[model samples]
Target: MGATPVQAAEDGRVNRDKLRELIGRMTLEEKVGQLFVMRVYGHSATAPDQVDIDHNLEEIGVRSAAELIAKYHVGGIIYFAWAHNTRDPHQIADLSNGIQKSGLQQTTPVPLLISTDQEHGIVCRVGKPATLMPGAMALGAGGSTSDARRAAKIAGAELAAVGIRQNYAPVADVNVNPANPVIGVRSFGADPQAVAELVAAQVKGYQSGGVAATSKHFPGHGDTATDSHTGIPYIHHTREQWQELDAPPFEAAIAAGIDSIMTAHIVVPALDAAEDPATLSPPILTGILREQLGYDGVVVTDSLGMQGVRTKYGDDRVPVLALKAGVDQLLNPPDLAVAWNAVLAAVRGGELTEARLDESILRILELKARRGLFKQPYVTHKGVDRVVGTRSHLASADRIAEATTTLLVNEGGALPLSRRRQPNLLVVGADPASPSGSTGPPTTVLAKALTELGFTATALSTGTAPTAAKIDEAVAAASGKDAVIVGTYNVAAGSAQSTLVSRLAATGVPVVTVAIRNPYDVAQLSGQKATLAAYSWTDVELRAAARVIAGKAEPEGRLPVPVQRADDPTRTLYPIGYGLSY
Candidate 1:
């Protein structure tokens, strides 16, 4: 295997010799072509049958992706997982090899960069068996830098197996607001310092394992209650406040040598709200990042299709605005023609001078050279087997699944439910019949794990108000049983989903409320009953709850983010990295 990209660039320096040698050989158009990153819908060149393939080709303007890369001199491809695309991992590896072998149009022979959103551990790739590690919050709950490293390694190794070099991961946003719509479980925690440490570890793990890592949402997207994927999230912190809260993680990650930084589509009125979102803001991207933090590596934009940019800037002009603002690459351009025309027009119109374009291309080429793409042998199908997912990786994933579980609140020594004593129990789900269907996986896992323990468990789903009949049955079942488990799966945002908690609180039974998804929900019912947080929707979290509740194991996991009240207290709901173990 080749050296990790970090080591290749190690001397604490960028190699100017090799960089100049490569840049001297590229044509103006060819060099310009390498600046735009296009999204590929399918796994391989032969994927999705001929009809689907032909349509994608006609629409994108290139049949085989190899042909596209060669014809347009496109520099990179970002992969995604939609049901229509081939899901086979090996096939994806083959496709990547084809693009690499398409060769360079210029003398430098720069290999096309392959990137993907394997943020939650290779969500897109087919070769690697998936690791059900809890999301970012779980890692924050686990409060182990080692776990952060492990998650990054899991993501890095899987992506590298399929020939993907860049990973958009280790979301650096600090989840200060529990109600943050999109970045909930994706962020580290509310504290900037904790977020910095965890995110840095993740970046180190990925880079050390030979995959480049990107720390995202530049100024920070963790405090907003809105999702930028849907609309522009306006952050209200002043410059001093922003520096204190949102800027630390990016600074820490860059100091640790993370390869890429992704810009978010957030509006900061104090900064550049009138002109552009952060992704296309020269003041933020160029002035703040390039100047203040001293980030010299590639700067990538978030998906151009996001409503934040598409709604305001318009698809026809985002590429130019982003380029002039110091973005290194346009990621996931919705309309390639629009991006191409916009960029070309910028150059012709002198809005984006040739010198500026060359500067961005130079950094990209430097990254490619550092990755040893120009020197290493082109990957072939023969080596495809050697690189895809392996048995050892799957085992590592299973272990991580077990380590990231959190038990936020417990009472009645109700966890590690005793099968010998409370043999018969009523499982109150988010709804009256099935909890997993209504609220997600935490409560479902509790229900399933209890069943595995040889206890007689019946799952009842309930909404804001448990049906009169279902509540009566649950109350009747609780009368004879030793305990009643209510699965309340509420998120930080949205409605409080705990009708079972409310109903069971009214009853005299020893009620245990398992917060399957949000920590805030557990906080809401603090005075009523025993509450615990699984922090995610994965199976491992449920099993962890099973072990703790069965008295077979102790609840060792803590809260990564603070849980607060409806009135919003000065302190968070649960303090950062707070956990209780018996």
Candidate 2:
């Protein structure tokens, strides 16, 4: 009913005159609340008796999403399935509409920025009914910016259709570390230039889709080994290397007019010796991102609940310090009231001026308006089915997934398992853990795809660390099958996962290994008859992998990152851009 965010002020940009006047009318508490993007636990926005509403009550002392908004004048709400905030497409749309309804009833009536970590592949928060895209590394493996743009566009449109106007996606990290615990396959690739190209494309794609895109973990979360959710990792890259390795993607995203840039919680001594992590570092956030890269877009912090960002700072102190460091948003602090009150107190105490808070509020208000939230914030529930998970999006996802199904090793031409002969296949491996905690989607998807293609495919989920009995069962299953397909997840050379692949390879059956989660798993799985990377263990990715094995889809993807030898990091086993096709 209204213009997309990208076109709201197509030529003139946001109405600063109106936004500033509205800011002048707001109380300091309201302005401070606008900077926070809090998380509430519930499937229904206004339902107090809904599932997981206790978490909302305990966290924010609010029983409903509507209460969280009306009580705090909250500016944004991020949904997570784990928090019981999302389910099917219609439920998510209804929840979003209810949240917007509460926000629109505010004194000044600003639209809430409803968002989620819809990073598709492995990090997907919403599933099934929402169309999933082949994630960043998959797009990188395919090495097509055009496809990347289309995938994000489709995903963005789907999210927007469900009233989710903001997506925390298009991970710009150039994952260089094989052992990176957090941002491995989530990144575009190991190369800065390639990652930059895809990031720019996705930014434009999401913008074109009516949802505001947030390019994230700014200054790069690619090379670090630590998971910021657990602990703070320090990057050792020099200032020049940061510019070369980490800066290009963000630079490109900014150039593409990305609506937001989320900050990383990691410490980079190169960027600022003064600031422990990039999230609260003025030198990094203000000096580098804002001044150096010239990004005028919203600077949102990585979750304040993360151990990395909260380690050196207090719960209340994190928000204040982050604001002082030029962050426009403080995302999901563990306690909402503490963060809000601390910020409110800082302004009242003259530690943080109301004028300072206005800077962030104005930008946030502009974002809300640009997204056409001012013109139309609600969506009809009927429209959710029409756009959320359409057939065309699924086809595009499959196409992108097929493009990323890379053949890393095909010794003796073990792949293209004979469909005419009707090979009985055994799909057995650990169903990798997703960020959302669900496992076995990829393993099951692979089996289903193989079976649909006329193969007798049986799937067995060997738990992450397979027990002796589980491995024996898998080995026994492989012994009877015509061929064995093992899905290895982030395997180290002599690790139990590598041992599983080795045991499967010795089954006297033609063994095909799929690097289901990380592409680096292939380096340790050298003994397998064939090896390929699906990049991520999502439905589409593994489905594409199955099609490739069954000769239905060609392995068109190349290695996005180099796989170094297990024993020596110096030796390259498979260089970047290395992928075999028969």
Candidate 3:
């Protein structure tokens, strides 16, 4: 290793001399390894009980994650919901510590960047022990950047305490398409300006709390109807339209000095004539994101396991293509060993230059240095319990949830449902079947909260979509009730939920429809006497909705996206910023 005299600047930037010296000492294999971020679990694959069943280890040509770390010298490890299966904060901390120890045992001893998809709300990968807040759309509905900043700070602090230095969150995509299967509630709002402000605030909050905030799915994935996880969704907007709608938030993120940006797999024909997804298109990644937007931070690709990228480029080729397109880190590459060897081959074959590879490695090293990982790379088990899901953090979550409950419609003052009357309430659509396997707070939370407020509340859930028989059963049950509170989750997917609510409303019981997930459910169930948008099915949001119904807490949330009327798709029933209070 050649040592150059490079001093640390006044701004505490990474010393160029130290970065170059570290690069000088690394072999080509080690340098290639630094560009890949792999996923790991708590247990070792080579263990007697775990052998042959460890598919991840089998693909990577390593018997154990520790062995992979020592040999491959991967730059980072990402934890998904499956990785945190133990659910115990102490166990999670131990796992993180173990990984860091193994990284230190390597010849180069570069610290691994511990990361997770802790986007909070329904998308939280680490559940229970982590404080669950209403996600991005709810924060936008609350209409307070300060609250968004506070929520991010609390989330960032908890993640940092558990040794997770990077959070793939604060989704900057604008939810302009209501039929958008994936980014609906995950986005901040339909308006670009509002989304930009909140995204910037979240970036500031995350960095302030010692965790790198990632503004994700660059060039926007919000307007497309398809989910990128399943296929390549094309965004058919021109450059002028992108500037007016999608590009503003990302521009704001760069200005906020976001630590990282994750690329979407969607194709933008206007940006690149080649039919390649943004992940493999230099015109989109290097040209638009780097040159046009002037983003100097690390650019990471979304999981290569996703079909969007997998269908076009197999696991063996996606990593090299992403590197050629200027992505600094390859997140969740399909096969670590194959991707690593492929990149090594590319450099040797002159497909990729060593100088180009060094640029990404330097950026990755700078990120690790900026996070102060070299000083303290491990976290204590006690720290996890102290910071994760503390009372104060939960309180912030509750406040945001309460503030985000938007009452979109209230016919004949049906809201503030007279708790004094002790009305018999039939609660429908509380626990719908989730296709994505997301677990929310208990369905009984809303019924229990309403019951405590002097109203007799009965809860019923007929999965994601109810059959005709189920609808009849619900209507029969609601016959004698004084009021009906029907909770709808993603009614746009099918007519079953809307049909049930419309039928129940026809029974002449003051029907109060609450949008449990998608706010656009209001447009479908227009016959309901009252409509509310809870945005998420989390406990805090459910309880907040119940309180608003009982006149306990005033709803302060506004619609973050427009609701297209069911009768006419061209017409919007409720515009953005539409909300009512008690």
Best candidate according to TM-score: 2
**Model 1: per-residue Cα lDDT over 202-264, one tens digit each:** 999988766789999897998898888899889988888899999999999998888889999
- lDDT score, candidate 2, position 376: 76
Q: Compose the digit string of candidate 2's lDDT tens values, residues 1-582.
A: 323222233343677887887788777778988999988888888784544677777778988989998899989999888887777788888888888888767776677999889887788888876788888889999999999999989988888888888889889988988889999988989999999999999999998988889998888998888999999988999999988898999999999999999999999998898757899999999999988888887889999999999889899899999999999988999998899999999999988999998999888888887887877788877788788778988888888888999998888888888887788999888776653423345667789889999999999998668878888889988877889888888887677877887787777878898888888887776568899899878778888998999999899999989989877889999999999998
Better of 1 and 2 by lDDT: 2
**Stretches of model 1 off by over 4 angstroms after superposition:** 1-15, 54-64, 83-86, 103-109, 121-128, 273-275, 377-403, 421-487, 491-496, 504-510, 526-529, 567-573
Reference-based TM-score of each model: 0.85, 0.96, 0.94
Error at 77, model 3, angstroms: 0.8
- Order the numbered candidates by lDDT, best leading: 2, 3, 1
Question: Which candidate achieves the best lDDT against the true structure?
Answer: 2
RMSD of each: 4.6, 2.4, 3.2
Ranking by TM-score: 2, 3, 1
Candidate 3: worst 10 consecutive residues by lDDT?
1-10
- Positional deviation of residue 151's Cα in model 3 after best superposition, in angstroms: 0.3
Report the lDDT tens digits of candidate 3 across residue range 1-582: 122123222254677678778788788888998888887654431231254236545666665557767778888888775653235566666666777777766666677788888777668766666777888898999999999999899888888887788999889999999889989999999999999999999999998878999998988999999989998899999989988898999999999989999999999888889979999999989999999999999998998888889888777889889999989999987677778889999999999999999999888878877776766677886788889889989888888888999998888999989866788988877475431123443346677889988899888776567889989999999989999888788886448887887789889998988888889887766579889898887777888899899988899999989888787889988889888877
Superposed Cα deviation of residue 415, candidate 1 (Å): 1.8
Identify the runs in model 2 with alpha carbons over 4 angstroms from their true place: 1-13, 48-50, 434-440
- 302 Cα displacement, candidate 1 (Å): 0.7
Each prediction's number of clashing residue pairs: 19, 1, 0
